[model samples]
Structures are given as C-alpha cells and as structure tokens.
Target: MIEARRLHILRAVADHGTVTSAAAALYLTPSAVSQQLSALEQETGHRLVERSARGVRLTPAGEILLSHTHVVLAQLERAEAELAAYSSGASGTVTVTSFATGIGLVVAPALAVLADTAAGIRVRVRDAEGDASLPMVLDRQTDIAVAVEYRGAPGADDPRLTRVPLYAEPFDAVLPLAHPLAAAPRVPLSDLSGDTWIGPFPGNPCHDVVVLACEHAGFQPTLEHLSDDFRAVVALASAGVGVALVPRSALRGMDLTDVVVRPVDGIAPTRRVFAAVRCGAEEHPLIRPVLDALGKVAG
Candidate 1:
C-alpha cells in the first residue's frame, strides 16, 4: 500500500529534520513535500511527524517508519543501480538455440565476439533445428533462435517474432569424385534427375528446399539416403550412395577429398538463415548485441 516514491520522501524528511529542508534537498516545493508526507501518513494511518515553529520532528510512530525507510531506501537504490546495468547491457545472461551448423557458423563465432567485446554477457547455447527452435522462441523457452526458413514457418510479419535476416547460403551439389559430372564447375538440378539423392529427412527445412528446387527443375528427386548432418550427406555422396545439396555454410572446414562440391547452376536451392526473438524483445540490451554479433559473424 506504500509507494516507493513516497517512502523516499519520508526518508528525506527524517534525514533533513524538516519539510522545508527536505523540499530543498528533493528540488520539490515545501507544500509538495508536505502533501507527500501527509499522503504517506494517511496511507500508513500513523502520525509520522510532529510539526512546530522550530521545525519538524518524528513522533515514535514516525521514528519507527523512518527506521524501516532506511532499509527500504537502500534496497531501492540497489534495484535502481541493477536496472541501469541491465538497461545498458553491461551484465546479464542470454539463452540462444540454433541448429548445429548455425551454432558453428554464427553462434560460436558470436560467442567469441561477445567475449572480446561484451564480457559481462554470458550466453547459453542449445542445438535445435529451425522447426523446433522457432517454436521455442515463440513459447519463451529461449531468448534467441538462429533458424532457417522452412515450410509452415512463421513469416516476417508474424506478430509473435522479430526476425533478423543473417544470411542466405546456396546448397552446393555434392557428388562422388568419380561421378560423370563431378568435374563440372557447377551442375544444374535437372542434370542430376537420374541420380539417387542424399538429403535431410522429410520434415527438415533443407528437405523442403531440395524437393521444391528439384520440382522446379522439372522432376521429383529419388531420395535413397537421409541424414540431417551435412558431413554424413557428403560421406554418402562420396561413397557413391547418392548426390546431395548441402548448405555452403555447413560445408565449411570439412575434408572433401572423396566428394566434389559444386554450386547449383542457375537458381540454386539456398537456405535463408535468421535470428528470431519474441516480438519487441529484439531491443533488449543483452539480446540485441547477441543478435548483432550473430549477424556480424554470419556475414
């Protein structure tokens, strides 16, 4: 029932020993200070001060309230100091979830960046695919989600999320080194119509992209191998099990001795990467820098 601001006024009067002195200390008019003191007394239903021409003094009731006010004011000061630290993004923890490749490409590098720059921020990372991660952000399970664009995914205009585009990477064609077209600089999707495909499973965003791209190229792919790992996809292609379209980012730093990676000719099947947070949360001091760091690393 007691207001923090009025408690502050009460503490000031007790400190200054008079309404007029407290008013000067607070930059408030004497009447304004007096009115706030009256309201505080009424709110507590206790005669908090005794006034005389000499000045003002606390009644025993006032003395007790003043004692409590000291502790309350100290706590209020601490809360204000913490709020200012949080508002400036100087210290906090932020949780992030992303698919494996995204973690490697963006989140990992981002952490390194924040370490050197915003050392006060601690980030917790989770590995989750776009389908799983997007919903996590929507439901408040995480502070940020680095995800891929996929079927049934929320659109940019979705009121629940604020999407920040990180990058779009083409799905490079992976072929057996001995395959007939392996030597080509780039291969058209239609040219591989007869080949067995190695791809992510049905529900994956990459799977939808590959299937749609193949359909646009005028044939539905015959997928004979499935795995979410790009390394496995490349291994399968290298062993002559099937050909695949793996994201360029996922291919980073892997040995490709047995398989050849080529760009998809004309209209490549690409994965659009982004970071998402609950609507209006993108401005959070800790979260915003993480997003910016992710974008910087992805770029």
Candidate 2:
C-alpha cells in the first residue's frame, strides 16, 4: 500500500519544485526525501518525479497524482484543524434555543460576534419561547438555551440544567403617546388603574407579573388585549389599543413613535434572563464561549 508519508514527499517535491527544497521544508535530509519519492514511485508503478541537476519536475502521471493528492492533503489538514478547534473549545457547531425577543435583541448579535471572532463555529439557533427552550437543553437537543422567568414563576428548578445569569431586565410601563400618564417622568402603577391593559398571552411569566402588579396596586387588571410578543404589545400600545408592562430589553428594538416607556413608580417587576445548558455537559466545548457572548451582550 502507498503510504501517505511517501505521498507527502511527492507532494512536497512538487510544491517546492525540488527534492532539496522539499527536504529543507520538511527539515529532513535530501537523501531521506529522495528515498521516500523512490519508494512512492515503486508503490504506484509510475515515475512521479524526474530529477535534473537544477531540481525536479512531475511527469504527466505525477501531475495527475499531485492534483488528487492536493485535495486529499487539504481535506486531511482541515480535519485536523477542526478536531483541534473542537478540543480547544474554540470552534464547533453550537445549537442554541432562545425566546423571540431575546433572539432578536441578544442572541443574534452575540452570534454575529462569535462568527467574526471564532473560526469553524457554526451556530444554529431555534426560536423557542420561555420555558419551552429549557427542554431543548435538558434533552441535549441544543448546546445552550436562553430562557426567562419572573421572580416567583414556576419551573425555575430544573436539576438537569446548569444555569448562568444573563440579566434581569426591569419591567416598565408602555403607554400610548396621547395618554395622560405617558408624559409622566415615572408612571405609577396607580396611573394605569383605569386604562385598558395589554397583557402577555395567558400562562406566560410576564402576563402574571402584569396582573399581579395591577392587583397589588389595588385594582384587578382589565385585560383588554393579550399578546405574547412584546413588540406586538408595543405596536398595540402605540395604536392606542392598551398599555403594557414589558421588560426593557424586549422593548429595545420597538419603535415607540406613538408610545412611551416609563419606569414603574413603586414595584419593579423584573424577568431573570438565564443561559442554561445540560447539567453534566457543563464542560462542553462550545457552551462557555456562547455563555460568555451572552454575558457580554447582556452587559
């Protein structure tokens, strides 16, 4: 069988245009390179190189073999490089799952940074809402997941997840521009008492927070609209549909032309942003970099 080392010698000779230069590049003696080339010729039953006083050149068969060798060697080099990067936590495909707003505001930018900084890393992101993203990490279906929860919300105790704090985005009042309370420097929960409320879709942590905030402020929230998407809620608020309580991060990209965001006067409802991976796989090569990226974006 033809050895790759012998092939290497032939390839090197062709690359350097001479056996002496090939030997110099390999840090091997010219005699050693000559022996390998001779052995390769015997193995292939063809003349691979013609040596002259000046140097050497490939014959017709040698040129064809060299063309094929170029592809094979390049592939092998790439495989080695990819394996090294995978081992070093520098590169690999990272499967990430995140909620809608988080993807647009946070994960997408972080991934863009990762693409620019880290080579051979391919990120595949799935847009899964809230706790739904947790299962992707827990089931090992994703390398990392960004999930959100209000302080007292259920399902924060997943033993299979190794959670990292990303951020705690404070909730703010989103009011229509024409509303009396919209001009306030800080809108109190009491200010929204009679206003129709735009709440998150039922069962979402943000939805519960909005309702509980209203009730704590001495009134039962009159939910005039329900939207899981913060942007949609903002759009509705801008259109005078209703006021909403939303996390600041979720509102970052929304155009508030007909709407205004103000700090809630009394109680500040915040949603905890967490980066989670499968518990035991905390040592995963691709996990830390993504987590680091998320942390950077959060900050």
Candidate 3:
C-alpha cells in the first residue's frame, strides 16, 4: 500500500520542482525528504525522480503518480471533513493565513464576529502574501487563506483547492494634497504618466497590478520608491514624495490628512480577495463557521 504521506511529499516535490524547496514547504529537512522519496520508490518499484546538475525532474511514472496523488489527497481531506462533522461540537482552533492588509480589513473583523457568536471556535492568524497562502492551505498548515488574485494564482475551479470570493476592491490614486490632480473628481492614470510613483517592490502582486495598470495607460510608471506596506506607500505620497495607487480596503482607518484618493476614470485596476481551503475541506465543521463569518464581514 502506498502511504499517503509519501505521496504528499512527492506532490510537493513536483509542485515546487526541487526536493529542497519541497522540504522547506513541508517543514522537513532535505535529507528527510530524500529518505521518504527513496522509501516511496522502494514501495512502488518505480524510478520517480531524475536528478541532474540543474535539479530534479519527474519521470513519466512520477507525473502519473502525482496526478493520482492530488485526487487521493483531496479524497482524504473529504473523509477527514466528514469525520470532523460527526465527532463533536465545532470547538477547535482554525488556522488562517492572509496578506497584511487583509488581516486588518477582513480576517480581524471576522474574528470579532466569531468571538461573539461562535465562542467555541478559536482562530490563529498568519500574515502571508497571496503567493504563499495558497500553498500553505494545500499543505494543511492553514485551514483557510484570505488571498488576493494575482497573475499566476490558481483559478476558481482548481481541483486542489476551493476558492470563496470575498471582495473585489479597486485601486485608488493617492496624491499629495498640493498636487494639481488631487482636486479632480476622478484621476486618469495617464494624467500621472509624467509623475514619479511610489509602489510595492517588484514580484509583489500589488506591484504587478500597479505596473500593468500603468502600462494600459500608455506609459510605465517611474517607480521612485518601493514598499510592500500600503500604509507606508500612502504616507510617502502624503509627504509629497510621489503618487501611489493603493487598494481601497488598505486605506481604511488610515489618516489621509495630506493625501487625496480618487477613483481611476477608465479601466480601474482592482484586486479580488477570497478565502481558499483544501479542495474537500471547505465544509469542515470548524472551517465552515469561519468562512461564514468572513463572508459576512466581507458583505
């Protein structure tokens, strides 16, 4: 019989393209991962991995096994979910992961709601970006992830996870109070073509959103300052450093004293936030209440 844990390790290796990366994702050491892979090969009587100077590649048999691994893992999750539903009250902890602003905007508020209503349930939160959260959910490190949609994110129907839509928020142009465009009811991104921009660092999803929006507006933004913190990005704009485009939700509760935020006139760039769970665990007793609370807060 093939051990599900070894199959999980194989899937991780395939997903990340390296045993070392898979180990990191699984919170195991490289040697441990290698040992598990070797054991799995002995059990299956198949060569599943090809090692080269560059890295490891999956053999055709490995690819086939990986496909089955996904289905088996999801089914196991379903069995666990069903068993949890039968066992007792929804009275355990649920681990959640989200980006920084999402913690403030959605997850925190949902925690309050859950505390008032489902006091038996507790939540532990981790601050992670969209890129990291989905994998965490798949690995069962997080029960649910409040993640944003980025270019490479899995689609809504991905078999490995289930995505529940929370909100779609637009990016607002933030300008210094003294800037001429600050007074406009709506700012065209093209109008800021010549202005210096403050934005998130490259490789961040928000950074890509801003860059793609600017490219659509006919010019690449001159990014003079980069920060992952939306609050810092807005603060920099307030200090007359440069203009910025920040998600509307991120601006909540911030003191915009010297900043002017206006909607973009055309093709407003927006980020879609959602909750993701392992494919078959969306309705797990402990997870369902939290997902409901988050949906309520998002609404």
- Top candidate, metric lDDT: 3
> Which has the greatest TM-score?
3
For every candidate in turn, the CA RMSD to the true structure comes to 18.6, 20.0, 1.6
Clashing pairs in 2: none
Candidate 2, run of 10 with poorest lDDT: 151-160
Pairs of residues clashing in candidate 1: none
Of 1 and 3, which scores higher on TM-score?
3
Q: Show where candidate 1 strays beyond 4 Å.
A: 1-89
lDDT of 1 by residue, 1-299 (tens): 99878877776677567888778767789999999989989999999999999889989998888777756655654565456556774688889999998888889999999999889999999999999888666445687999999988989986457799999988889999888998899899999999999999998999999999999999999998999988889888889888999998888898899999999899898899999987656666677789889988877
lDDT of 2 by residue, 1-299 (tens): 87867766786687568888778767789999988888888889999888789899999989888777745654554465456556785666888898877887789999878877665678899987665666455334577888877534335464335678887877899988898987789988977788898988776767767777788888987898987877788999989988889988777756877888999997687777788875545445465677778888888
User: Against the true structure, what is each candidate's TM-score?
Assistant: 0.70, 0.64, 0.94
Q: What lDDT does model 2 reach?
A: 0.76
Quote the lDDT for 51 in model 1. Answer: 95
Clashes of 3: 0
